[model samples]
Target: MCRCIRLQALIGLLFLIFMVPEFKAKAQVETIASQRQLFVDDFLVDQLERAELEMHRPVDEGIAFNLDKLWEGKFSLYTTIIKDGGTYRAYYRGLPDVKEGNDRELTCYAESKDGINWYKPNLGIHEINGSKDNNVILVDNQLTHNFSPFLDTNPNAKKSERYKALAGKKVTGLYALTSADGIHWVKMQEEPVLKEGNLDSQNVSFWSSSENKYLVYFRTVDSGFRSVSRASSTDFNSWDQGVEMKYGPTPLEHLYTQQTSPYFRAPQVYLAIGGRFMPNKQVVSDEQAAIMGIDPNYYKACSDAFLMSSRGGNNYNRYFMESFIRPGIGLNNWVSRTNYPALNIVQTGDTEMSIYVNHDYAQTTAHLRRYSMRLDGFASLSAGYAGGEMLTKPFVFDGSALELNYSTSAAGEIFIELLDEKGNKIPGFSKEECQPIIGNELERTVYWNKNTDVSKLIGKPVRMKIYLKDADIYSFRFY
Candidate 1:
C-alpha cells in the first residue's frame, strides 16, 4: 500500500511539471491594446493564403531646397527635418570644402510653412566668413561635423531642453546638446554621454514613448562593415551600454547612416531609411567626375537609400532589400555618398506624407529632394484580382471600432471576419456579415452587419481574418 501511494504521488508531480508550461503558453497571447499595427513586417501576421506583404516606393516630388547658400555648399549633409507644430524646421551640416579639420563645418538651418518649399532663415547666431547673416546656427568645429537634432516630445522634458541633438566624431565621442527653442542650443554636459564605437556618421536620437527611454542609433563598425548600435537612457545624460544591431541572415553591408526615427503615425515602430554604401562600385569615370567638378575622393564609391524598421531594441527587419529611393538618372547621383535619406517623415497633406533625401552629393547641385508617400503606405498586405486571405495572430485589444488605412480599386473590395482564440468564427462577425469596404481612404472604419461597435469584444483574445481582392491594406488599428 505504501509503494502504490508513492507511485501515485510521482505521477502527479510529473503531470504538473509538463502541463503547466503548455497552459501558460496558451495564455501568452499578445496584449496589443489600442496600438496601431503596421504591415511593415510579419510581426502581427500568422498566416497568408495567396496574399503578400508588398513594399511601396515613395514618389519623387522634386527639390525641397538647394544647397545654394554660401556656407551651404557641395558637402552639406546630415539633414534633419522636424515638423514642430505648424512650422517645419530643417537642420544640416554645411561644409563648403572637405578639408583636414572640422573648423569650417557649420550647422545651418532652414524652415518652411509647407514641407515642399523650404527657405534658409538668417538666424545670425554664428558667424561665417565674417558675416552672421547666414543661416548658420552653431559653429563649433567638433560638434558641427555631424550635428543631428530632433524636437523633444517627452512629457517630463524641461522647457529649456525642448530640442535635443547628438553630435561628435570618433575622437570626441558623442556629445549631447539642448535648446529651449529649436534654434539656440547649449551642451547638456561638458562630457560626452556615451562613446563605445566609431561615432563618425549622423547619430540619430529620439524620445521613445513606447520604450519610455531616450534611444540613440549611431555608427559602429561591425565585422569590417559599417553598422549601427543602439543605446538607451532614462535621462539624456546617462546611457546604458549599447548593443550592436542585428540584421538577421542578411549579408553585411556598409550602412553609412541609419536615419532611424519613430514613425509619427505609429511611434512604436522605428523606420530607418538608411544609406547603403558600396565601396569600389564606381559609376562615373574620372573624366565625367572632373567635368561635374566632383570632389576627387568622393566619386569612387556609390550609395543609395534602403528601407528598414524595428519595433524596439537591437534587431532591425529588412523586409525589402531593394533600394527605397534609387539614385535616379544622373551621373552626379551615382557618385559616392549621394542619395542618403534625411532624418524624418512628416505629414504634408491630408493624405500625403513626405520623405526628404540628400541628392547630387559632392556636386554643384547638391540639394534635398522631397518624396511623397500615402500616409502609412510604407508597406502593405496586398492581394491580386484573384481574392486571398490573411489571418492575424491572436491578441487582445481595447477599442470600440476597427479603423483601416487602405486603398482598393473600384472593383476591388475588402472584408473582415473576427475569430476567437481557437480560430473559430465568432457569430455576427463572420465575413458574410461584413460590409464590403471599397475606396481609397486614410482611415475607414470597418463594420460588420452594418454595425461598427466592437466594444463588446474588447479584452477578449481574438484574431482578424482579412479577405481582399485587388486591394492593399497599409495598416489597421483599434480605436
Candidate 2:
C-alpha cells in the first residue's frame, strides 16, 4: 500500500510538471542599433500604460515656386529636391499645354541656395518655347511624366553618374538615365530595365547603403486602387521584378502616390507620405471651381497626404489613418491632385524641415508650396496631464547615453526606466531613481539619478519604460 501511494504521488507530480502552466524564458533580442526610430506607431511597442498616439501637422510657409515659366504650368508634378553639399537642386515635370507624347512634356529644373527662396536657373541645356532661356533640363524624350532623380551616394559611384534618374511612361517602360551635374542627362542603358508592372508612376530609385545596392519604389494597383511595389538592382541597368507591398491587416484604400524614401535622420525607417486619393470625394462645387478660377476637370478627385513607414523589405506600416496633411480652407487646394507632396523632405532650417506640395493644379496660378515641421516631428508618443507610461520591445543597442527629441509644457515632465529583457525594472535605473525631464529639444540626453552614461548596459538586451505627463516624444535614440 505504501509503494502504491508513492507511485500515485510520483505520477501526479510528473503530470503537473509536464502539463501545468509554466513560465517560458524570454526571447533573445536583435542586436541592431536603434539610432533613429520613427513614431509611426506600436511597431516597437511592447506595452502601453495609458499613453496614446499623437499626429503633427505641417505649417505652410509660402509658395516655393511659380510654374508660370516656359513649358511649365499647372500640369507640373513629381517635384524632387536635394540638398547637394551647399547648393539645393529642385526637379519637376513641365507641361504648359497638355496634349500627348514626349513633345508636350519637359523636364524642368530649379535651384535654391537656402531652400526658402528658389530660382529657375537657365541651364541653356534644352530648348523650350523656341528659346534656351527656360529652366528645362531634358526635352524631346521619355522623362516628362515622371523624371525622378537622386544624388547618388554610393561610395563606388562614378563621377559621371553622380546624379541618377529613372524616367518612363506606361507604354515605354522605365529607362535609366545618368547625369554628371544633374543638368545634362543621358541614357545609361538602351532598353528598359523594368517593365510590365505598372511603370506609369513616379519610379524613384536610390543607392541604399544598408543593402549595398540600388532600391526602387514604384506604383501598382491593388483591387483597382493605386498601391506600391519595390525592386532592386546592382548596376542600375538590371533589376528584379518588384514585389507588391503588404500593409499588414489594414484594409486597402486608394493610395495614388506612395513617396517611400529613406528618412534623412533615420534611413532604416523609410518614410512614406503618400496621396490618399478619393476618386469622387469632391468638396468643391462646379460653380465654386469657376468662381475660384480653377479647372473643372481638376476638381473631380481629392487627395491628402498620409503617413507610412517601412524598415527595408516590401512592407509598410500605416499606423495612423488620420491625415498627415490636409487640403486646407481654400478653393485652389480643394481641387483634385493639387495637394500632392514632393518626393523628398529636405532639411531647410536648424530646427525645421520642409516638404513641398503641388498646389492649385490646372489653374493659372499653379505653383509648388512649402510646408514646414520640426525636425523628426512627424508623429509623437504623447500623454495628457494625468500622466501615462510606455514600454518598448527588447532591443540591443550600442550606445552610452540616451537622447530624445521631445517637447513638453512648462508643468509637464518625462521619466525613464531601463528594464531587463524580461521586463523587470533594473536596480539602479528604476523610475524612482529618474530625474524629471523638462524642456523642448531636438536632442536632449536623458539622465537617471544624475547619471547620463549607460555604457555598462550597452550590448545587453534591455527595454525602456517612458513616463510622460502632458509631454510629446517625437523620437528616441541611443548614442
Candidate 3:
C-alpha cells in the first residue's frame, strides 16, 4: 500500500509540471482572426527550422521634386505627406537662409494627384517677401519650424477639425492646431496640450483606432540621449503625463525625429521611420565639404533613417538595427539630417508604396527623394536554396481561405501546412498535399490538394508550418 501511494504521488507531480503548463499555453492562444500579419518582427513565430527573417531595403527611385522655389531652398525640411482620397498633400518648413532666424521660417504646401508628380499651388494664404503669390500656408515662426499635420480619421472628430497638427519648441512646449481643409489652421486652445518634453523635433500625433485615443510621440532626453516619449488623450486638447519609450536592451542612440504613424493596412501596428543622428560621426573632410558646397557645421555629424515598430503604448520593437534608407554615394549625401524620412508612407500603386526622404541637406542640392517598396515588403521571412521551414504559434482564426503576399525565384517554391494544437498534422492540409506556390504576386491564395476552403477550421486553434526554397514571404492573412 505504501509503495502504491508513493507512485501515485509521483504521477501527480509529473502531471502538474507538464500538463498544467501545456493547458495554460493553449488557453492563451492568440485570436488572430483575419488580420494581416507582416514579417517585420517575430510576433507570430514559434519555431524556426533553418528559416530566417530578413530585412529588405527600399529601392531608390530618384528625386521626386526639388526645393528650387524662391521661398523654398536648401534649408527646407520637416516634410509630411498625406493621401486624402485622390489628392496627395505635402507640407514642410521653407527656410531659404537659417541666418534670418525663426522669423524667416514658413510652412509651405504642395499637392499631387498620384503622389509621384507634385505641383505647388499658389495659396495666397501668407505673404512672404513682397507678395502673397506663394504656397506659404502658415507664417508663425514658432509653429512653422516643424509643422506636422495628419488627416484625422477618428469618426468622432468634427468636420472643422478634420486635419490636426502639433508644433512648438521647448520654450513654448507643444501647441495643438486644427484645420478643416488642411490649409488654413487655428490654435485648438490658448495653452499647450502637454508641456513635459523637449518638444524640439517633429512631434508626430495621430488617432489610434485600436487604442481608441489620440497618440503622440515627441522628443525627450533620456540619460543624455535623444529619446522618445508617448502620451494619449481621448480628446485632442487634454493629454496624459506621458511615459518615456523603452527600447529593450538596445544601446541608446540619438533619434532626431520619431515619425510614428499607424500602418495604413494594419492600423494596429505603428511604424516609425525616423532619423538616427550620429553626432561627430564625420565622413566628409573640410576640403571635401567645400567642394560640395556643404555647410561647415553640418558636415561634422551625419544622420540616416531607421525603422522601428510598436503595437501600442510606450514600447518600440527595434528588430533591425541597420539603416532603412542609407545615404547615396556622394559627399552631399553624408551630411547632418539629410536622410530623414518624411512623416507618412503613401501607397503609390496597387502593389507599391513610397517613402520620401530629405537628401543633400544643408546644401544647395537639398531636395525630397522617393523610394519604393512592394506592399508589405518592409521585411520578409526568407529561406535559402537549401530549403527551410517555420512553425507559428497556435492561433484561432476566422477565415475560409489563406492568402499570402510573397515572391519567389524561378526555381523557388513555398508550401504551407496546418497543424492541430497538439502539433499533429491536420488532415487534407498536409504539406505533401499542398499545391506548391511559385510566383511573385502581391496576393496569392494558398491551396491544398487544389482546395482553398478551410471553413471547417474556423474558431479552432491551430498552428501553421511553412516550407520555403529560395522564396520570401512578406506577409500572410486568412480571408
Candidate 4:
C-alpha cells in the first residue's frame, strides 16, 4: 500500500476504536472536566450557582431508582454505579439475611440503559450461594465475603487490562477485586490489602476527580463506638494510616457517639451532604430551651442534615455548616430521624446535578426519595464589572411574576433598576427595600413584587440590575 493510503486507513481505524460505547462513556467524564473553564460570568452568581439542578424526585420504579427494581426481593444498600458500554451497571449490598424471610448476606447486580430504568440480566453473569444461576453475581475467589464494591478503570501501563473494585468488610481488612469485564471479579490472593488502624472497612469509594487522589471512606469504631475513618490509596492496595474525621462538635459524654457515612458524592465544588445524629439529652427545662426548638436536653435530636466539608481535606475544621431546620418529605409518616441518610448523586448534563437521599419512613421502614437543586444556590454574589453590564438578557416572565433567585448573607437594602432598549435607565420605578431578615450571618432569598406591571416590560428588551453590597446571587428566574 502507498504511504498516503496507509495513513488514511490508520486514521479510519482509530476513529472506529473511539466510537465504541465503552470508550465514549469514559470520554464523557473527561469532556466535562475540560469544559470547566466555561463558568458563569457574573459576580452576583458565584461558582456554585453555575451548575443547574435538573429533575429530582423519589428513586422508585421510574427514572430515579432503576437499581432498586433489580434487588426488590433481596436485601440491598450502599448502591453505586459504573458506566459501561452505553449504560450504567450498578451493584448494591444484597444481604440475604436481611430479607424479611431469609437469613444470608449477598451482593446483587442491576443494569440500566440510562442509570434510571434498570433491567436484571439473566445472562448467567455469576452465581450466588451454592447455585450458579442465582441473580447475585460474585466473581471473587472464594477467600472472604465482600461488600461495598467500587468500580474504577485501571491506569497502570503494565496491568491496565483490569477494572478495579474496593470492597468493605466487617472484619478488619480491605480487599481488592479485579475484573476483565465489570461482571466477573477476582479477589487478590494477598486479600485484605490494608488493615493498619482499628478501622473496619465500612465503605470504599474512589474520588474520580483529578483534584484528589484515590480516597477510601471507611466506617470504623473508636473504643467500640461508631466513627468515620478516611484514608487514601495509590495502587488500590496500600493505604495511608486511617484517621477519624470529627463530624459534630465535641463528643457528648452520655449518648452514644453517632456514626457517619464514609462515602459522599459531591460535585466539582467543595461541598458535601451527609448525615449525623445527636443523642437527645433532655436536661434543661422546657421553657428555657423552647425558642431554639430543643427538648431541654443535652443532645436534642440530631440537628438538621449536616453539610460537612473542608477546602483542604486534611484540615477537618475549616468549615462546617449544619442546618437546624429540616426539609420535610410529606408522603409517609417517617418520624423525623436526624441521621441515617443515604447519598445518591447523579451528574446529568454539562452543569446539572441531582442528589437523592434515603431517609427513614417510619422507625423501621425507610423510603428512598430524591431532590434536585442547582449548584448555584450555594454561591455568593460579588461586585461585577463597573458601569453596569448586561450579564444575562432579560428573559420574559413565563408565569404570573418574575422571581429573582438570590442569596445574601446580610439583610440589607436592594436596588432593582430596569433599563430600556436604548440603555436609558428608568427612574422612580417600583422600588421596595426592607430589612426582613433576622440575622447577618445566613442565606435568604428575596422576591420581586409580583403586583408590578411586568407585562409592559415583557414586550421590550430590558435588563434588571441588582446592587448587593456583600451577598451572593445564585440565580434569577423571571417567571
Predicted structure with the largest TM-score when compared to the true one = 3
Report the candidate with higher TM-score, 1 versus 2. Answer: 1
Per-candidate Cα lDDT values, in order, are 0.91, 0.84, 0.90, 0.42
Please identify which of the two predictions, 1 or 4, would achieve the higher TM-score against the true structure. 1
Please write out the lDDT profile of model 4 over residues 1-479, one tens digit for every residue: 69999999989778877876433332111122111111122212222222221111222221344233323332334444555556666665444323321334446666766544556676466545444554566544221233455445334413532566666445446677676666676776465776654332235555445444666666656555545567777666677887776534554221111212222232333333444444452323445334333222222343234444333254233132334124455322112232233433454434444444434322223334444444443333443322121233332333333434443344443445555533356543323432232223222333334343445554455555555433444444333
State every prediction's TM-score relative to the real structure.
0.94, 0.93, 0.95, 0.52
lDDT of 2: 0.84
Tell me how candidate 3 scores on lDDT: 0.90
Give model 4's TM-score versus the native structure: 0.52
For each of the candidates, give the backbone clash count.
0, 0, 0, 18
TM-score of 3: 0.95
- Relative to the unseen true structure, what is the C-alpha lDDT of residue 151 in candidate 4, on a scale of 0 to 100? 42
User: Over the stretch 290-376, how does candidate 1's per-residue lDDT look in tens digits?
Assistant: 999887889999999999999997999988888888889978789999999999999999989999999988888989999999999
What's the best-to-worst order under lDDT? Answer: 1, 3, 2, 4
Query: How far is each candidate from the true structure, as Cα RMSD in Å?
Result: 3.4, 3.4, 2.5, 18.6
Q: Could you tell me which 10 consecutive residues in candidate 1 have the lowest summed lDDT? A: 19-28
| Model 2 lDDT tens row, 57-150 | 9998989989998588778888888888778899998887463244688888999988889999878876665777878887756667889999
Which one wins on lDDT? 1
How many steric overlaps does candidate 3 have? 0
